[model samples]
Target: MDVSVIGSGYVGTTVAACFADLGHRVVNIDIDEEVVATLEAGEPPIHEAGLPELVATHAGPDSTGRLRATTDYEALLDTDVTFLCLPTPQHADGSIDLSIMEAGAEQLGATLAETGDWHTVVVKSTVVPGSTADVITPAIEEVSGRTAGTDFGIGMNPEFLREGTAVEDFQIPDKVVLGADDERALADMHTVFDPLVDAADAPVVETDTRTAEMIKYANNGFLAAKVSLINDIGNICKEFDIDAYEVADAIGLDDRIGAKFLRSGLGWGGSCFPKDTNAIIHAATEAGYEPAMLKAAVAVNDRQPERFLGLLDEHVGVADRRVAVLGLAFKPGTDDVRNSRAIPVIEGLQARGAEVVAYDPVAVENMRSHFPDIEYASSAAAALEGAHAALAVTGWDEFAALDAAFDTMATPVVIDGRRIIERREGLTYEGLTW
Candidate 1:
C-alpha cells in the first residue's frame, strides 16, 4: 500500500514510520523544512521512546524501503490513501480550532481537483464530531468536484497515541477504529491498517463516521474526567485526614473502572485531555445541551495549579522562599508541555515573588523556551539544591527515588503530584491531594 501522511509532528511522523514498517510505501508531507529535513536525516525532531530506533528501522534513508518525506503536496497525488494527521488545536474560547485542518482540506481539495486522482483520504487527527462530513468532506468535494462515496472516498480514523508511548501504542493499540461512510472505503482502510491490527493483536472496530470521531473525544474526555475525579477526591480527602492513595487503590479493584487513569495528581495536562474535554462540553452546550459533570471535571482540573500552590502555602509559607519544581512536562518520558499544570504552578509562585528553579529529565530545554524568566537547573538534584521546598509535578522514576536521595535536597520538603510516592520517611512530604 502507498500512503501519504500529512503533518509531520509527533503523530504524523510516527504514523508514517509505523506504516513504512508495516511494509507500505509512505510519503510524509509537512510544511516545516526543518522537520522534513530532520526526518530525512534519520533523526527524530521530537523526543519519544523507541522513536529514533523505529525511524531508523523503517523510515531511515539507508533502510531498504520506499519511505520518503517531502514538503510538497504534489507528491500526495500518487499515494493510494492520504492520512490527515494535522492538528485540530483548541481555540481561545475552548472550541476546536479547525482553521488548520480546514486549510489543509481546501488545499487537498484543490490539489485533488487538479490531479484528477481518485484516492481515499483518512483523517487520523482528533476532531470534534460532525467535522468530517460537515467540513472536511464538503471541502474535498468542492475541490474534486466529486461527491463522497460516489467519486472520492473518505474516512475518519482517530489516533490514540500518547506522546511518550506513541510508537508503542501504534504497534500495540487496543483497537483500530474505522469510521467510514461506505463499506468499500472502510474495507480498503483495513488493508492499510492490517499490519497494525496483526501487530496489536487487536480487533478492528468498524463504525459510522460520527461514532468514530466521538470515540476519540469521548475516550480523551473520559480519561480526563477520571483523572479529575481522583484529584477531586484527593482534594476532599485533604480536608479530612485520609490517605488518597489507599482510597484510589481500593476503588481500583472494581472491574468496571480498572484503575488506569484513576491517578490523583496535579490534574491532567498535555494537549489532548484538557482541550478535548472542554471541546466536547462546548459542543454539547452549542447544541442546546450541557454536560454538568464534565463541566465540573474541567473546573476541578482548572483549579489544580492553584490548589498545588495553596498546598505549598499550607505546609511551608511562601514569603521570601525559593522553591524547586521537579519535572516540567505534564508526564514523564515526553517533552510536551502543552496545557501543563506546571505553567500555573510557576505563574502562581512567581506571583507570590518566590523563586522557582525547575527541571525535567527531558522537558527542561523546551521548558526554558517557554519560560525564560525562571531559573533553569541541569538536574533534579540541582533544582532541589539549597531550595526552601520542592514540588514533584511529574512522576519520573528519578523522582520516586527521592526517599533514598533525601540528601540531594537542602530542605526536607517534597510534594508528590502523581501519587507515585506515598511516604518518603524523614522528609516533610506532602501529596497534592494526599
Candidate 2:
C-alpha cells in the first residue's frame, strides 16, 4: 500500500512510522519543514516509546526507504491512500476548532483533482460525529470539483493511540474501525489495515462515518468519566479515612466494572480526555441536551489540583517558600505537557508566592516554554534539594524509588498526586485522594 499521512504531530508521526513498519510505502506530509527534515533523517520528531526504532528501520538511508517525508501536499497525490492525521484542537468555548482539518482537507481535495486514479482519504483525526461526512467530505468536494464515493473515496478511521504507548497501541489495538459509505472505501480501509488486522487478529468494526467518529468520542468520554468517577469516589473514601485502593480492588472483582483507568489521583490531563470531554459537552449543550454525568466528572477533575495544593497547605505556608515539582509531563514516557496536571499545581504554588523548582526526566525542556521563570533541575534530587516541599504530579517509575532524596529537602513534606510514593519515616506524605 502506498500511504501518505498529513500532519507530523504525535499521531501523524506514529501512524506514518507504524504504517511503514507494516510494509506500506509511506510518505509524511507536513507544513513544518523541521518535522519533515527530521523524519527524512530517520529521527522521530516526538518522544514516543518504540517510535524511533520504527522510524529508523523504515525511513532514512540505512533503512528500506519505505518511509519518507515532504512538505508538499501534492506528494499525496502519488499515494493510493491518504490519512488526514491533523489536529482538531479545542476552541475557546470548548468547541472543536476544525480549521486545521478543513485546510488539510481542502488541500488534499485540490491535490486529488490532479490525479485521475481513485484515491481514498481517511480521517484519522479525532473529531465530533458527522464531521467526516458533513465537514470533511464537503470541503474536499468543494475544492476538488469531484464527487465523493465516485471520484474519490472518503472514510473515517479514528486512531486509538495513546501518547507513551502509541506504538504498542497501533500494533495491537483492541479493534480496528472502518467507517465508509461505499463498498470501495470500506475495502480500501481494510486493505490499508490488513497487515495489522492479520498480525493482531483485532476485531473489525464496520460502521458509517458518523458512528465511527462518535465511537472515538464516546470511548474517550467514557474513560474520562470513569477516572473522574473513581476520583470522586476516592475523595469520599478520603473523608471516611478509608483507602481508595482497597475500594477500587474490591470493585475490580466485578465483571461489569473491570478496573482500568481506576487509579484515582490528580485526574487525567492529556490531549485527549480534556479536549474530547469538553468538546462533547459543548456539542451536546448546543443540541439542547445537558450531559450531567460528564459535567460532574469534569468538575471533579478540575478540582483535583486545588485539592492537591490544599493538602500541601496543611503542612506549611508556601508564601515566599521554595517548592519542588517532581514531574512536568502529563504522564511518564512522553514529553507532552499539554494539559498536564503539573500546570495547575505549579500555578497554585505560584499563586501562593512559592518559588517553584521543577524536574522531569524528559519533559523539562518542553515545560520551560510554559514556565520560563521557574527553575528547572537536571535531576529529581536537585529539584528536591533544599526545597521546602515536593509535589509528585506525574507517576514516573523513578519517583517510586526516591526513598533517600526526601531527607535532603528543607521540609520533607511530599504531597503525592499519583500515589507513586511510599510512606517512610523521614518524610511527611499526603495523597491527594488516597
Candidate 3:
C-alpha cells in the first residue's frame, strides 16, 4: 500500500515510519520544512523510544526507499490512502478545536480534486465523535467539489500508540479499529493495515466513524478515571497512614482489577489523557449530559501537585530556599512535557518563593521553554546539591539508584511523588502516596 500521512507531528511521523517498516511505501507530508528536512536527513523530529532506528532504516539516504517525507500536498494524490494525522487541540472551554484538522482536510481535498481515481482519507487524529461526519467531511467536500463515499472514501482509524512505546504499540497492538460508513473505505483501510494485522495477530474491530471516535475518548476516559480512582484511594490510605502500594498490590491479585495504572501518585498527565478527557467531558456537557465522575477525576489529578507541595510545606518552609525538582517529563522514556505534573509543582514552589532547580534525563531542554529562569541541573546529583529539599516528580529509573546524592542536600529532605526513592538514614524522605 502506498500511504501518505498529513501533518508530521508526533503521531504523523511515528505512523509514517511504522507503516514504512511494515512493508508499505509511506510518504510523510507536512507543512513544516524543518520536520520534512529532518525526516529526509533520516532523523526523527520527536523524542520517542525506538523511533530513530525505524526512521534511519526506512527513511533518509542509504536506507530502504520505503519511506520519505515531503512538504507538498500534491503528494497525497499519488498515494492510495492518506491519513489525516493533524493535531486537534482544545479550546478555552475544553472543546476540541478542529481548525487545524479542517484546514488540513480542505488542503487535502483540494489536492484530491485533481484526480478522478478514488482515494481513501483516514482520520488518524483523535477528534470528538461526529467530528469526521459533521466537520471534516464537509470541509473536504466543499473544497473538492466531489461527493464523499463516491469520488473519495472517508475512514476513521484512531491511533492507540503511547508516546514512550509508540513503535512497539503500533507493531504489536492489543486491538486495531477500522471505522467507515462504506465498504470501499473499509476495504481500503483493511488493505493498508493487513500487514500489521497479520504480523501482530491483533484483534480488529470494524465499526462506524462515530463509534470509532467514541472508542478513543472512552478508552482514555476510562484509563484516566481508573488512575484518579487509585489516587483517590491512595489519598484515603494516606489519611489512615497506610501504604497505598501495599494495598494496591493485594487488590491487584484479583483478576477483576489489574495492576496497570495502579501506582497512583501525581495522577495522569500527558498529551492524550488530559486532552481526551476534557474533550469528552465538554462533548458530554454539550449533548445535555454532565459527566460528574470524569469531572471528579480531573479535579483529583489537579489536586495532586498541590498535595505534593503541601507535603513539602509540612517538612520545611521553601520560601527563600533552593528546591531540587527531579524529573520534568510526564513519564519516563519520553521527553514530552505537556501537562506534566511537574508544571504545577514548580509553580507551587515558586508561589512559596522557592528557587527551583530541576533535572530530567531528556526533558531539560523541553522544560526550559516553560521555566527558562529556573536552574536546570546537568544531573540528579547536581540538582540535589546545595538545595534545601528535593522533590521527585517523575518515576525515572535513574532516580531509584541514587544513594549518596541525598547527602549533598543542605537539609536532606526528600518528597517523593512517584515513589521512586527510598528512605534511608540521615535523610528525611516523604512518599506522596505510600
lDDT of each: 0.84, 0.93, 0.94
Off by over 4 Å in 3: none
lDDT of 3 by residue, 165-187 (tens): 99899999999999998899999
In model 3, the worst 10-residue window by lDDT is 425-434
- Put down candidate 2 lDDT per residue, 286-401, tens digits, no spaces: 99999999999899999999998999989999899889999999999999999999999999999999999999999999999889999999999999999999999999999999
lDDT of 2 at 390: 95
Give candidate 2 regions above 4 Å deviation: none
Alpha-carbon RMSD of each model: 1.6, 0.8, 0.7
Clash count (model 1, backbone only): 0
* lDDT (Cα, tens digit) per residue for candidate 1, span 160-274: 9998999889899888999999877897799999887887788888988889999998888888888889888988988897988788889999998787877787888898888
